[model samples]
Structure formats: structure tokens, C-alpha cells
Target: MTEIPMGPELLSPGQSCLATVEQLLDFDFDIPAFQRPYDWSDKQVSELIDDLSDAQRKEVHLFLGLVVVCTQSNGRFAIVDGQQRLTTLMLAIGALGGTGKILRPKGGGVSSLWISPRHADIGFAKALVSTSSETEQTLSQRRLKQAFSKLSDQKALNLATLLGAQLIVYVAPSLAGATGLFERINLRGKDVSQFDLVKNKLIEWAAVEKDSIVRGEIEDFITARYDTLYRRLDPSSKEEPFDSDKLLRVHWILFTQKQFKSSDKVLTEVDSAIDETYSSKKSIARWIESYLDSLVRVAETWVAVERPYEATPPSWAPQLKHALLDFARLGRDGELQPLMVAAIIRWQADATDLVRFCEITSFRSALAKKNSNHGRSYKWRVARQLYQGTWSDALKQPISLAADAVHQLFWANTPYWSQGEAREFGEDLTLEQVGAEVFPDNALDSTRFYKDYRHLIHYFFWKYGVYLQHSKEWADFTRIDISPFQDSVWFGNEERFKGWDIEHIYPQTPADRDTREGRAHLKVMTQWVDHLGNLTVLPVPDNRGMQNLPFIEKLAWLREQKKVPFNELLATPDYRGNLLNKPHWGINNCKRRITEIRTAAAKLWGFDAVRELGVGPYDNRLESYQEDIEEEGGDVPDNSAETVAA
Candidate 1:
């Protein structure tokens, strides 16, 4: 009989079949030398045996997964997809000796069933088939032996069942056919990710151009860089690893503000999007070149999150590292990632201010959308504009971005405070405090300032710390000098207060009283519970201890017991002198204290510099605050006289 041609034609339809143990051993399986080394751990080995045993008990035909083999010109079968399974099966049979012999070609020189590539694992695989002893067995060999270790009681039946198990054996006639089949499986198979599909689509497009060189280059680049990119992402999740597709989509959105919901859309629409601005091959090539560059850089930025800044950072390093770390941790969920990436890339040399600017912008956006997540469409529009415009423009007109983006953010709903009531009462405040020129109309409604709790707390502490250090009031309240409370406290290193939280100055709960007086105390607690005036940042552990303490006892603890800077600030006469005389901690004192704190914030946040700095004529950005007048049936409270000592 004439033999079939040694090419893809040999893999014609209906050429596939199942093989028994005896037939499979006679077939001369050759593990391709180019394949990756055995990486299946012990768990996989055990699972295969357990599954096979269960199939046998149920009396069902066990269909192991697919195995693709190429018929070589020399008539040997080259194992493709099921190398792990096939290799494990041989080891299992070797462990169970009575069934049949695993053979090598007959000069009897290489008597093993498997031919492994020359590597550390090759010797290990050889030892598994050649010996029955467990002594000095490699990890893989040990796992293989363990799978069949208990089956020594019924070696013949178990080995027969596993070897004869049916698998869909795909026989490709030639090497090229096998490769094409493998590539298709990896690209469109069940485990395929959007990244894999998108990559395949890109190469397919290149292939359409009949540019084998370009196609080959692209494939090579993907094969080489795929693992490196995945290693950069969070490893805990197995469902979706580092989403390269999302990364590319973000870059695309930055440039076009267009959303691609699936891998198909990315490939189908990306070229048209490029064509809108550039129709020539040269322009398309340049665009792809830049896109690839951004991908590489963004990957580096993502990985940089796991590490700390170098000991000696550049002038701008602190803010950049802080922003990168924050994004690495919290900022990933937001729409501002592209902007964050842009800042990192642009200001890398002196990225301090730019990173800070991005952090502020991102946090501000987060605060703006506190009730809901920022939508991709919103971020898309902003990112597109930022990309089309210059980075300098973004830095120069932060307020414009703030105002425009905020207006766009809550375009559908009326503005109001998110959760908290205004601590500083104001309706007609001009933004001139930061200076009139800096803002459009140079007026920011200070009433909305307290709504962004985190930004406010950070700004207050940093500014207050700097001011205290300069005025020789770091420890002492007045000209009566005292030793510095703590030398150079800075939020620059957050680990210094890793366990700290924003502590309420007035305890959220009043002491429990059972009598009529106790009931009255409880009422006061309820009235002032979450009041803005009552809060300050302190160590979480210290705050826990202070909770449930009586008002006066808390005061004494702050003054005499706690070394916490903010707690000490509250204990100072300038801050609590008015409250000191009050017989009880009531709603009145909380309101008045809130007013004093607001005044301090105004100074720290440049309320006085507004006019000189051309800062704002911006209104408070809270939906709750916007309805304050209608909700209360009165104008927002007037704390005009509640100014602090500036």
C-alpha cells in the first residue's frame, strides 16, 4: 500500500482515532525538542489519576483532554498539546509494571518510552521510566509515582483503564499544520483572554497585507513579552490576570474617547480610529509604534507600584512615587489611569508636582463621584481632551479641568454636599482668598470645602504642621516655648502613621447615663455625632481608647495623657478655650468649634491668597449643599464672624 504524503494532507478529515495502551506504546511518541519543559506540579499529576480512577468506578469512558500530534517525515508521532498528560501516563504505567513494557527503538540502547529534550528535567523523566525505586526521585518523578502508588494492589486494571482512556487525538500531517492548529487553539480556545484575541487579530491584519515579516515580528514580540507583562500585574486573581486589553483600551480612550467593549471591537475599530487622523501607511506605522511604546512604559509604571522610591529621589520624586503607589493600590479602579500614566511619563525627570497634581485630580474626581464610580465615558472625554491638548495646559488650568469635569460629572443632578453639613457657613464667598485671578470669577464657595473629608484632612495637617514648625508652636501654644512635640512630622512617609485614622475631636458617643441627666447626655451625643467640628486625625488605636469617654475626661486625656499632635492641638487654649468654660459638651459648642476650624482651613487652603493667586470663583460642589437653602427653609448658616487668628 502507498503511504500518505508527509504534510497537512495526511490530516484529512476522519484521520483521528483513540489508541489503547499497547497501541500507543507501539506508536513511538516523540516529545518535540522545542516544547517548554514539564511544568505540571504534583497537584496536576494527582488530579489526573483521581479523575481516571473515578471514571473507572463509574464504568464510564474517560475522555482525557485533546492531544495534537504531527506525523513527522521519519514516521514518528510528535506530541503537541497533551505532552503533560502523555508524559504522566507513561510514568503511571512505569509505576505499574505488570501491564506492558515501555519501549525505545530496538538496538536496545535507549529503552525508554519518552524522549525528553536535553535539560535538567530530561534526566528526571528518564529515571521515572528506567527505575522502580523511589530513592533520589525528582519532584516530577515523585509526583508521578505517588499517583499510582496505591494502585499497586490492582496494577493491571488501573494501567489498562488509564492508557485505554479515549482522547480526541488530532493528527496533523505536517509540522506547519500542527503549528497553525496550536496557534488557533491558543488564540480562540476556552482559556483565551481579550489580550490574546486582540493580539491574534493584529497579526491576522498584518497577514492580510501578506507581510509575513510584519506578522512574524509581531508574533515574536508577543511571545517574548507576554510573560513579562503578566508578571507586572496583581497575581492573586486567577480569573483575570493583568488585563493587557484594558491597558490598550485605556490608551485608546485617551486618544479617541471611544469605547471598545470587546476584543472584536478593538481590532475592528482601532484601524478606523487611526484612519480618522492618519490614512497613510507611514502614519499608521508611527501610530502603532507610539502605541507599542506606551504599552511598554505603562507596564513599567504598573510594576513600579510594588517598589518604594529610591533613597535619593529627584526633586519631584516624592509626589510621583506617592501618586504611583496610590494608583497601584486605590487608583486602579478610577478612570484617571491614563492621566496618571501620562503624568508619570511626562514628568518622570521632575514628576513631583505633576504627580501631586494628578493625585489631587484623581481624588477630586473620586470625591465628586462618591455616590457612584466614575463612568468610562466621562473619563474618556476628559482623557481625550487632555491628550489632544498639551500637558502644560492641563497643569496650568487645573481649575478649568476641575470646574469643567465636575460640571460634566454631575451634569444630570443638582449639586449638594455629599454627606456632611457645612462647617463654615457661607453663601457669597468670593474665590479671591486664593487670589481673584487664579479662578474664573475668582470665587470658590467655601461651604463645599468640608465635603471632601480626606483632601481636607491631609491639607489641614500638612499646612498646620508647617505653620507650627515655623512659628515655634510645634509643642507649645504660645510664645511660652516648650520642647518640640515631635521632630519634623511629615506625611511624606505614611508608614509613620500607618495605623492612624481621622479621629473625632468630640467623641461620637457621650457617656451612658441611666438617670434623666443620662438621657439628656445621650440626646447631645446624637445631635453632634458626625459634626465636622468634632473630627481630627489621630492614631486609630488612640482614637479607640478615647471613644465613649466623657467630654471633660476626654479633654484631660488629650491635654495630659496623649502625645498625638492633633489631639494636643485640640487641647490647646486657642482651640478649646471657649469650650473649656462650657459645663457640658452640647450642640452649641460643636457648632462654634466647627466655625473656628473652618477659619483655620481657609487660611491653610489659601483663603487669603485667593485674590492674589487668581484662584477661584467656584461654588461648593455638593448636591446636598446645593439644596441647603431649600431643605432648611433658610439661608446657609452665617459664620462670617467665626474667623480664626491668621
Candidate 2:
């Protein structure tokens, strides 16, 4: 590899050139309408001052990151990226009275910034630089006041910060280029991903093409799609959110029929995959453009499929939602993420078969087989068949895995269970089959399959309770802590919403563990505790209140919820019977409740041959909350059903 010698700029990008903050402020920049208003809080303004002060003290140039812009008429430029930072720098310089000392106002104005009308306090922004103060009537003015106050507090904003703070400025040949450039630079990760490299490659090609119109078209295609892609694709509420690496890892294959090798870093894996497959430059470009298009097209539905906490899923397409949620419980489906992106966006084929195929494959693998090896065996082969004629998958072949063939196709991918056959899956399943299969019974005929499939079990009960109540929306779930670096999503807020959790009907520990009989009784409770029959959802408060109480007392408490305000649990037919008459919830109760729930769950989760409209399945009650279940998040795994990678 021929190495390019590095420059003294704070950061390096081959396609971008360096500029100082002082050099930047003298040039006029038209803040476009799409740019967000200048609304930096006092803390943000203080931090920016503190950062530059620290850098000045250290006598080091701070890399201010990339500034992407497109040249406009009158020697001015339209701000695409760096609008926020650039605007702040202008305010800081003006507060320090350095504006008049700088050279050019090419627009021949007092200020170089052409504030967007969307900026609520354009008067205040202009006043800050032009020495005519505006009243703080709007939120924009309030924010501007804070920034000016901070800058004035510094007495004199350092000339070193303006001179030594370095940034690379990319003058995009067109608006499309500017947008595409912004997209690449804004990808939230320390490592450069394939998306960034591909954008860089496209920029290199556009330079070769040199035709502004052609370059614009290519960039325009990417520009139109990426806004939606970045906004909706990543579950921001999640601790470790999705990034370019994840987008490439899981969905890249569906778009390009490329498999991610275990050894591959996200940066090289994609480039290598494309290089091996598409030799021609034209083929590679077409595939990337289409993949980006597919990503944008799939983004909304994908977010819906992996909706975050505190958001209620739309009530429409209830069956599909339930199936997606059930699939989520099986853990993150890397194989399915690509397939789902394909199903929802790129493919012309029907999605029922796709969902059905993935449902069975994921369910059977995670539950029955307990490993996804066989389920993921033909991952790329399926992609090939599905997208045969598309640019990503170039082989012209007939599409085969329709509704009728979906079952057998999955059968081809999955390993046969000791007693399993195609019909056992293809045909409509019974509670007996679910008991024997999906949530299988152990050698003692007790495991009650999917018990270990934690997310689904938790989700099922939560959703079922809502379904039973005929509620319009899902209840607020306590967003669990996933990142040790960051505290709870609601860190400073009230702790009242501990969110709901899995509760065992039969306690895992005896309330009187201190006694010999309590210890002896605990042995009996452990056998049935994890089973679906033994499970139900309860609020953290209720679960704690009723936890380790006797079975009859728990049932009586549930009955009290019927009259209790804000009590979601109803002692309906499912919970009522001779159980209040009995002291303990026996194996017979587990069998009966398990059967009832299985029937309801089968209908809700779409195991039934026909789609039903009116109602859906249920899941719930208390075990002392275990870390394993809470820690293994996502009613869906972070990677499996929703996305992939750390």
C-alpha cells in the first residue's frame, strides 16, 4: 500500500482540507432551512468554552471535526454540516469583540451568517454580532443569551482557539454531495465503517466523473435516503445503539447476499464481500445505491418491529406485531434481520411466508434445538433465491419460498428433532404439540418450552394482560439498565415506574426459608417455577407486595386488583377456579393453565393456520427477579431479533 504523508492538521481526511476557526468566521455561511435552530443550552456553551480554554492552555490544536458545505453565489457557502459549531464560534467571537478585526464580510454585511428563518431568534443572533441587542422573547434568544454570557465570562475568547482549533472543510460540488458528505461524517462510532469508506469511494468516483450533474445524481440518491435511515434505524433509547457496523453486519447480506465471517471487522468485511462479488465498478455502485434505498425503505417498519420502551406499538396488524414480538423473544436474529429488511423493503414477493419461515426457524432453533447452527446453515443461499435478479444477487433464478413452500424450505435449513418431521411444524400445532415442542416438556414432561426463551415469556405475559384488559396501549415498561457507563434512561426522574417483570405463581423461595418445612416446601416450588404455566406478568410494586406470599393469598390479591385503582392484573377465568380453595398451586394447575395459555398464545403469535381478528394471547406472576433474565435484555436480544454487534 502506498502511504500518503500526514499533515499537521488536527485530523486527516484525504478529500477534505484544513481551516482555522478565525479563517472560518470571516467567510459568509447560509444556514439552510433544514439545519436545526441554534439552541445550545448554557451547559453546552460552557463546555465549548471550557474545551477551547483547555486546548489553549495545553498549547495544542483541537480537531474541530469536518465541515461540509456547498458553494453558493456571491462567494458564500451553504452550511450542510458544522452549522451548530460554526454558529456557536461566530457568537463566541462576536462576544469577544473580534468580529470587526476579521477581514471579509463578502456579503458586505455587519455579520457573515445568513440565519435560517427556522432560527427563531434571528434578530438576537444578528444583534449579538452587530452590537444591537434584541429582547429575549423567544427560546432561540434565550439560548443565544446563555452562549453570549459564557463567552463574555471568558473576558476574551482566545485568539489561539480561533487560530489553533483546526477543522477539515469539504466544499461539496453540489447540495447532494454536501448531504452525502454530512451523512458519512456523522456516523456515530470511533471506527470508520464500510458506509463511510463507500461514501469516500463514491466521492473519489464523482471527482473522476467531474460532471457536477452526474455527481449530484449519485449523491442525491444517497442523500434522499440517509436522513430517514439515521433517524429511525437505530433504537436511540437502547444503551448500546445501532451504528454503521450493525447496519452492515445484519442487513448487508440481505442487500448483497454477503455473509459476515466471524473473523471480520466491520470496516473490511463489507469491502471484501463487495470486491469478491462485484468486479465491475458499475455493478458495485448500483448495489450500494440500491442497498441504501432498501435501508431507507425498510427503516420505519424495522423500527416498528423493534420499538423501544415507553412507546406503545400501533394497534394495527396485531397478529404481525405479536409474531414479531415472539420472534424477538427468541433473541436477536442476525439471520432474520437481513431477511426481514428484505421482506419489508426490497423484495417484490409476499411477506407472510417470510415471517412464517423465520418464525418457525427461530422458534424451533432456540427452543427445540437450543442452537441456531442448522437454522442459519443456508443463510446466504436463501438470500440468493430471494433476490436472484436484483443487482445485489445477480443470478437470474425463480423465486421459490412462497407461503406453500416456506415450511419445507425451513425444513431444509433446520435439523430434524429426534421425533420431529415437516408436518409437525408445517401443519397447525396443538397445545399438546406446543407443550411437546415449542415450549417442550423435559424428561419429566415439565420444561414447558420457551421458558428459557426469556424475552418472549416476559413479552407474552405483558402483552396478554393488555390484550385481556382490551387496553388501547401497552403499559410503560421500566427501561432496564444496559450500560454501566450510563445510568438509567430516567436517571434523575421518579423511581415509581420500576416497570413490570416476570412473576412466578409458585415462589422460587419459601417466605419462611428460615424453617425446615419452608425449606422442604421450597424444593417443591423450584420444579414448576420457570414454566409458562407458572409464569405471569406483574408490576414491580405488585410483584414485590405479593412476592413469596402463599398461592391463595396471591390469588386473593389478584382478585383485589379487579377493584383496585390502576391495578392491571384481573383475576379473570384464567386465574380463577378451585386454586383459592387450595393452599398450594399444584402440578395439575400448571398443566391446566399451561394449556389455556398455549391455546391463546398460539392464536396471538400466529401458529394458527387462519388469521383471527378480535383478541390475542396472555403471559405473567412472581419469582424473585433474577439478574440473568433482566440482564439479557430486549424482550428481544440486542443483536438477534433487533440488530447485531457490540
Candidate 3:
């Protein structure tokens, strides 16, 4: 019998069969350009691999669930369902074995991947199949590289050869049929998320109650939400976005006051909550409606909160854009998300204060380090309180920062004020008393800070640039199409800054730097070279590592190339006066630059809050405070005393 022609073959409508990754590859599959990119988190990827290992030990065939595909105009299969699993299967092939042949649809086209990602990452995926590639990359590439390391070479090959995972392929003749099937199985059957589990129960109840309208609403609501949010959860996104499952889980926590104990636990909690709804005399239709309503409240805002530096400020709360960004950066483990979404919902009229409260509280938690697991222990409670209207509205206004709070941060190693002495109070604080304060390489000594403070440098400088841009707001920058936090642009890695990197105003290594034959003219500038003042965010090609080029040439080349973004460090008056007009850059210039940047840092951080913004150190963000309006106009105490210990 003639072998079926390679690549997509026309199959009868409704044809279905069990297939392995090997057999599945016979069809050339194309993910629509609009489909969500590869986004399995490190944990998710590891779990998939672990699941394979478990299957291997049991000597059982892995039965991964259904994959739905339909024919495209090019005759390649458009992946309508199971993209994550299919892509991961290819990734597994590329990892445990060479994908040189397996990656191609049929002919092993040099330009094609068996599963083509969005147009931009097609090459990156191909490079991934090859061995001895770059170890440091971001996004899908980084996660993929990490996934490749999970098994030993012999073990990987063993699993690749011996493990025959059975996947059910439901091949549809047309896109419309594929989409309908996708919505059904994707929502109802994919075990990756439990959204469909609770949803199915709701529909079942709806059917029993004969509530057809609400059932239809649930379907429409879920379809719309998933379609809109899928791409937003792309692993390449810098926003640390949530998958649709996490959104439902967070909503569960918000209403139930339960921790995300486990996937099984979530279903149990959801089931219990469903029982509670029924016992409370609430209609099943109303139970789901209420849950969906809460989802609607936070789902859109939840995503907007984590947008990177290039997106325009969201129109609903443009002023709170930086606050949202800062909050997103907090507890990068997602402890802040539930609280952030709840704040937007509860205090919709006062977006600024609520968003900033989340920002400041998240900062306080960061200061507390591991001691405060607000995400695991407290954020859920906070979110629940806000939802139930039990949390004091006083939290909607700024919490007064204690005077002692600002000094340790601004003054660095300075001695704390004596407990006996009465401390001054204010809406903010400043570094008016810095001369006597010094710590050995403490954070305040901007001259001493360098690459050791990478996170601080990137986050703050980008923030400072934002501050300068928006009439000195965010005390930060607001756009997120690219990032300024990274010192170098990573083309295909997660957490990359495609447009910016740290630029040393003075070449860190000039041709003359190593040619110091006699120590007559040059002092050991090693310590000062990486100082905070010497660096600023600059646009990329990185001009072939221009940090080594002669200073004057850098100015001319950069000016000619317009390698400077319009609103960041280049636009500052300090940039004009310090480097643009200077004929030479030396240790003194870096020293001079530090003072200006530190003053900005003092304000950008909470140090100079009172002097700069007329609010407490934690309240530098505008409109993030108001006079106490509680029944007694009581002062909301600052519970985050550990703010300076960090």
C-alpha cells in the first residue's frame, strides 16, 4: 500500500484515531498567528516531563488527551486544541532526541517547525532543536532550554524511544468544525486547567433547573474570556501574566478565603462552595452568575496590571499605571495579584490610592523578604476582605508612615533615632540628613552601587525615567513595549529588554583602559566604573558594545543613529549638562552624576517622600492619599515596620 503522502492529508470529516507524537507528525500543523505562543511555565514543563517519567516507570503507554486540528488554506493542519501539549511533545522530541528530522511537517523543511509558532519565533524554535545552543535566553527559549536539562542524555533518549504516548487526534475537515470542537474539549476536557470542571457543574445545574439563558451566558462568557486572555498569557509576556486557570483560582480565593492548596484541593474547595451556595438557598444559576460577575470585575484589570514598559497607560487609570507596574513587580510570585484586582474592584472610584497601596504594601513585603509571605498568607485574606466589604475603607487612603521608617533607608547605615526622642510625622520624608550617614556599600551610596545591584538599577532607572516623563509621576516610566531594566537586550529570552541596556557614559574599557603603561595619568577607576551615576538606559543594537568605544565617537554615532529613546535618560537636563556638554568622562563625572541620580532615587524610593510629594515616605505616588475620613478620622497605622531592614 502506498504510504499516505507526508504532511496534511485530506481526511474524512469526523475521522479520529489514537496516535503517538511520531505518528502525529505526519500532518503539518500550523498554529494560527493569533494563537497564544508557547507559555508552559518552568513548573508546568517539569510536570509534563515528570508525568512522562512516571509513565515510563509504570511501563504504561502515556495517554495524553485529545488534540483537535483542522485544514488551513495552505493544507497544513491549524492546531485548534492541545497546542501546549503538542508543542511540548515536539520540544520533548527536540530535547531527548534531535528534532532535525522530526521538526519538519514532512519534508523536514529548513524553514518549518512541525509545529510552527508565531511568525517571529519560528527560527528560535528551530535553533532549539539543535544542540550546544546558548544557555542564556528568555521566554519560550529559556523555558525550553531548562526543560531540555531535566533528564540525563541516556535517559532522555530512552524515554524518547521507548515511551509511546497515545494522543487522540480529532481531525476536522474545516476550521469552523475545529473551532467548535476546540471550544468543547479545550474547555471541557483539557486536564491542564480545572475551569471546565466547575463550569461543567454549573451547566449541569443550569440544565437541571431549566435555566437555558444563564447556561448560554456562561458559554458565551467563558469563550469570550478565553479568546481575549490566551495571547495575554503568552510566556514571552513580561507582565508575569496568569493563565485562565489562575484567574479562576484567584477568584475562588477572593470569595472563599482559601489558599490554592493544590489543583485537587481547588476542585474540592469549588465543590464545597457550590454546596454552600445550594444550602444558602441561592439558585445554581445565581451562584455561577455571581462567580462570573466577580470574574468580570477583575479579569480585565488583572491583566492590565502587569503590562510591560511599552504599553500606553491604561485609559481607566492612567495615573496609576506605574503603581500597577510596581505592584506587578512585587512578590513576582503573584502574591500581589489578588489584592491588586480586589483593590480595583472595591475602590473603583479611587484607583490611584488603591493601586499605590498595593504597590507600597508589596514593597513592604519585599523588604520583609521571606519573613512575610503576604501572597500565601495574607494577600488572599486581604482580597477576601475587600470583596466582602469587611476591610476598613481607611485602607483606601494612605497609611501614615512612621518617621523612623524613612531614615534607615535614606541614611543607609546611620544609627536609628533614640526611642526616647519624639519622632516627627509627615505625609512623606527626605534625605536632608545624609552627610553623617554612611554604610559600607549600603544601598544609599550610589557611587558604590554597580552590577551587584542589577535588579535595583534596572527597576529604579526605568522608574526614574518614567518619573521624569509623566510630569515626575511613577517617580517612574510608563510605556512597556520594551524594557529598560536589562543591561543588555536578549533577543529570544524571557525577561528581555529588546530596546535598552545599561550604557556606561564613560567607556568601562576604553582602548586606553588597558594601556596604562605608566600609572601617571590614570588612577585605578575600577570601583567607580560601574557606579550608578556612570550608567543610564540606552537604546539597543548596543552599537556593537559601544561601552568600549571612545567617548566622543559614542556621542557622534549615537546621535547619528538616534540610539537614544526620546523619554528616558537621554532626555534629562542632567544628560544634556553632564555628558553631552562634557569633553571628557572621568571618575569625577561619575561622582557628580551619582548625586543627581541619588536625589532622584531618594524620591523614587520612599526616602524623600515628604519633601518631594507632600506624603509619607510610602505615599510619594500622587492622589494616593487623602485626609482620614473614617467615622473617627482615625490614623491607619503602618504595620510594615520591617520596611528598612531590607
Candidate 4:
């Protein structure tokens, strides 16, 4: 092994040099104490191999990027970056039957690299080199084996030549300088995520602990929670899963009740907050405990926000869970998440009231945010104040406070609109008023109801279907039932909305019938083609099977299937004389059919009161809301149903 002199000349930061892989790997590399295990999965390793092999095939020199290293006085070097590439190179060379140990240092006593210095056995490379079959191979190890399989003798020799002659590395003067450079480069690039930095800080603190017991416990905590948190934060990523920085900001809001404006400052802000609050060691210990608890709370809160219906509805807080499901169905927004976390923590028992308050607040706030003329400070200010209180303390205040706050905020911000004008208000109406206004008996008159507010169709079905199924008269519900409707889609082994389709009562077929009577019938069907009266929900298979069939034939098929609640409701004999029973369903029958259905819905939802509250000029507010959400990288649920041909 050739020893390159490291002197004052090479001690400068950002010093550039051209060195072969053999020359670079000569000095033993240390994988610093704070670093995570070698986690480059098989796919990544294979890509590196393929890239190098392709370079060899094309006879092009491949420059493997900077391997930032900190030179130690003991003639060894600590790798600060590009360890995955270096390690994979060694593995590939080893598979090629190279016994020279050119990848490792001179003394057989020590190898080329020290992975996780104090915890050598904890990394993937150690498991690979060790003869112990008991060692649990990680994804990277499996990939190493797979990468080995891809290498033939000639290819391996070519790779060896490339490694010995082609690679370049940038070595910084000292370990501290190199570490700083590593951090800056990675933080500025995609190489390192905020999660990695935060993890390093925690583990670095753990490494400094005087007590072994405390250190071990912290290490164990990190091991248990690290990947779990990472996976939860980035559910989509299996390989380089790292999206928990936003989560840290959420933690900041939950703790401080204030927004952390800069995502990059999240770690520093959180650290400062912790340092300020927990100045003493004992306090810091307590903070760690509380921090772990917050991680769980925030993670669970996120899951609830995105997938409320996924969990078994909490039996003790079913109503709150139901309300959360509504929030989830409405849309998942990060700004709204803190309030939900607070609700779940404190006021979950009053789930119905809490959900109503949030629903009203969410609509008002979203509108305010969309209209840049109106500021969002008031919403955040009130949220901080409301969320800081305990459940009992929160409940002590008037339930109307939320509505009052929203109205007051809007009144102050939206000065363009008349302050006293009820016509400008949308969700500012009371829950009962909202229900009535949104689903009045006369709702059938509006053809716009079908395209807009499709989500409410499920809600209406849940309420009326449950009432009918329980043998409670619809009239009885109108007068006395104040209980919130639980979603029937969640009942039984039947998954919620798995097979449900939005079906048109009248199909959208052409009026191509040659005869006069047939032509009139076709025109009527076409006229009410998109009416909510003509729309109902059925299972996908049932809906598919009913395609372009005559209304009577479709009705007969629905009876056989008995899969859709709303369809089954329409099939019942008790609700005849309306559009459902017409021998030849025409436009008038369509209007009557929807009118009866709307009346039933109005009994539960209070549609007339909603109408009295006055509608907004933004009739397609949901469409705009959806567009804004999509623009912000949020997903809006597709609630569109299948339409029948006229």
C-alpha cells in the first residue's frame, strides 16, 4: 500500500484532488459515531454498478462524485460523504475474487473502513463481511448479493481498472471542517433530509451522555421510533423515505401554538424551544419524554386527518371519529390539522359539536386564505388561543364562540362585503341552518345539486337509510332526532365505498327513437340527465349491469341486487305515487321522485333553514376549493358517479 503524505499543504478546506478508488480507499475510513447504518437498498447499488459497467463498456471515464473525508493524524481518514458508493465498490471488488485487500488498509488488524465507529456490528457492511449466518441482512446486504450476481469476471476486472484509475475525491483538511462541509453540501442538496440532521443531533447528544444506561435507552428509543416515524412521514417511499420535517413543524405548532414559517428553520427552532423550556438536565429528560409523546400524538393526528375511516372507530368517541371521517372526506389540510389534534386530545367526547365547529371554521378560513385580500392572521391567532385550553376549560365557554370568532374575523377582514349582510355568509350559518339550507325540500329544483355536493349524497343516504332500516318513520326523524348520522358504508364486512358508484336516475342516452312517443320519452330523460333527483348511489357491479336499461328494468335489477341503500330506499313500496313508481318515468315524474327524496333528506338536514340563511355568489365554491387544493399538491376525492344514457 502506498502512503500519500498529508501535511500543511493538504490541510486547507475544499482542497481538490484527483485520486483513484484504490488510492482513496488506502487510508482506513471511519464512518463517524453519529452516522446511521449503511442503508443504500439493492436498487441503488445495482444502479451504481450498471452506471459504472456502462461507462466501462463505452470506454468513457466515470467520475464518481466527491467522497468528502476528514484526515486524521493517525494516517486514517474519516468518510463524511459518499460511503455508500465506496462500500459498494469494495463489495463488488471482493465478489471479483480480489484477495489483495487493496480496499482495506495495510494492517489486517483494521479494515479499510470503520462503520459506525463505536458500533461496528450495527451496520450492514459488518454483517456482510462476518461469517455468522445468524446476522440479519438488511436491504442493502441483499442488494450487495444481487449486485455480486450481476458482476462477471471480465466486468469485475473492468470495474477494478475503472476504480484504480478513474475515480476522484475531494478531501477537506480536518474532521470538524469536513463534517461542516458535509452538512452544508447535503443540507443544500437532496443527499440529506431534515429528518437525518435532526436524528444526528439527537444521537450526537446521546453519544455524549456520561451514563451508559441513559445512552443505551436513548439509542434503543431512536432505533424503535426512527424508521417507524420515517415510514409514517413518507408512506409512499420504501427506499429513501424521508418526509418527517413537516411533522417536526407540526410538533412545533402543537407545542408553541404558533406557526414556524421557515421549514429549514424547523430543527433550530425546535431545539431552541426545547433548550429554553428545558434548561436543566432533568428538565431535558422530561422534554425528551414529552417529545416522544408529541411524536406519537402528531403522527396519530395525521393518520386521523388523512384516513379517519381506516381505523376502527373509537367506541368511546365514535361521534368524534365520525366527525373526523367527515373532515377526512372533506379534505386533508395541514393548517386544519392542529385543531384536529387539539380536538382529539381534549374535546373528543363532544365530537359532534367539535366537528361542527371545525367544519365551519375550515370553510371560513379556506375562503379567507384563497382571497389574498383577506388576511389569515386572525385564524391562526384564534387557533392558538382555542387550542391552548383544556377540554373542560374549552367546554366551559359558549359553543357559539367559534362561529362568533369566524364571523368577527371575516367581518374585519372582508370589509369589501357588507358587515351586517347575511347574504355574504356561507358556512357561518348554524349547524341546523346549514343542514336545512344545503338540503331543503325544494333542493330538487336545482339541477346544479348533482354536480356539486356529491359527498352529501352519502350523508343523506346514511341518515334516511338508517332511519328506514330501524323502522323509524321519516316524520318522526324530522321532529325529534338530533343524533348525528353514523356512516352506513362502514357497517358489516363491506368496506366503506368499495363498490359504490354515483349512478344517474335517468341515463344520458341519445333521443334517437324514431317514433314520436319514444322521442318525447328520450327528451324527458335527457332534460333531467344531470339532476340530483335522477342521481343515486349503487354498487359498481350493479351500476355497470344497469347500463342504458329502461327505468323499470333498472329498478327490477336493483331489487335483485339490494346492494345500494339509496337504490333500495327508492325500491320500497312505502314511497310510491312519486317518481319511483311511475309506469313511464317522465320529466314530471323525475322532478317528483327527487322532490320526495329531497323532502326526506330535508327532514334530517334542515334544507329550508339553509335556504333562509342565504346562498353565496360562489355557487361553485367547492370547484374553486378543489382547484386550489390540487394546486397546493393536495388530493381531492373523486366522488363522481356513473351516469345512465338518456
By TM-score, the best candidate is: 2
Q: Candidate 1: which stretches are off by over 4 Å?
A: 1-192, 209-214, 234-245, 255-268, 271-290, 302-316, 323-333, 349-351, 361-513, 536-547, 551-564, 568-570, 577-646
Reference-based TM-score of each model? 0.53, 0.60, 0.52, 0.56
- Give me the runs in candidate 3 sitting further than 4 Å from their true place: 1-191, 196-242, 257-265, 276-283, 308-317, 322-333, 360-376, 393-448, 466-496, 506-510, 517-523, 545-547, 550-584, 607-646
Runs of candidate 2 with Cα error greater than 4 angstroms are: 1-23, 29-189, 210-244, 249-251, 257-331, 346-350, 372-374, 389-401, 414-451, 462-498, 515-520, 562-588, 598-646
Query: Per-residue CA lDDT of candidate 4, range 1-646, in tens?
Result: 1134343244344566666665554456665544444556657766776777777777776777777876655656656677666766766655555524533444756644332232433344443444234333333344444554555334454646555544445677544355456677777647565556666555555554567677667755754565455434432212333235665655555565343342336668656755665455444444555566567666756555545554433554676676576555444244555555555555455534445444433433332234321233333333334455521112244323332333333333322211223443443556565443322333445576666556455544554555455554433223222222344443212344544677776666632356576577776666566777677776566577677666677777766665545565555444433544344445665565665665554443332322222323333211222121222223222222221100
Poorest 10 consecutive residues of model 3 by lDDT? 413-422
Please report, in order, the local distance difference test score of every candidate based on alpha carbons. 0.47, 0.50, 0.52, 0.50
TM-score between model 1 and native? 0.53
Candidate 1 per-residue lDDT, tens place, 1-646, comes to 1132334344443267554544455565776644433445657765776787787888776777667786755666777567777776776776667323653545746544543422434555555565544453233334444544544444435666766676666786544455556667765545644554444344334333345566545544543444344434423211123455666666555444333232334554655645553545544334444555555555665334333322123444554665454433332334556654444454363444433433333343343443223343333444444444421122244423433343333332222221111112233434453332222111122323334344445444544444554544334652312432331232223232344566655455455555576577666656455556555665455567776665667777656644445456655555555654243455555556555554543443322422222222334432222322222112222212221101
What range of 10 consecutive residues in model 4 has the weakest lDDT sum? 637-646
What C-alpha lDDT does candidate 3 achieve relative to the native structure?
Answer: 0.52
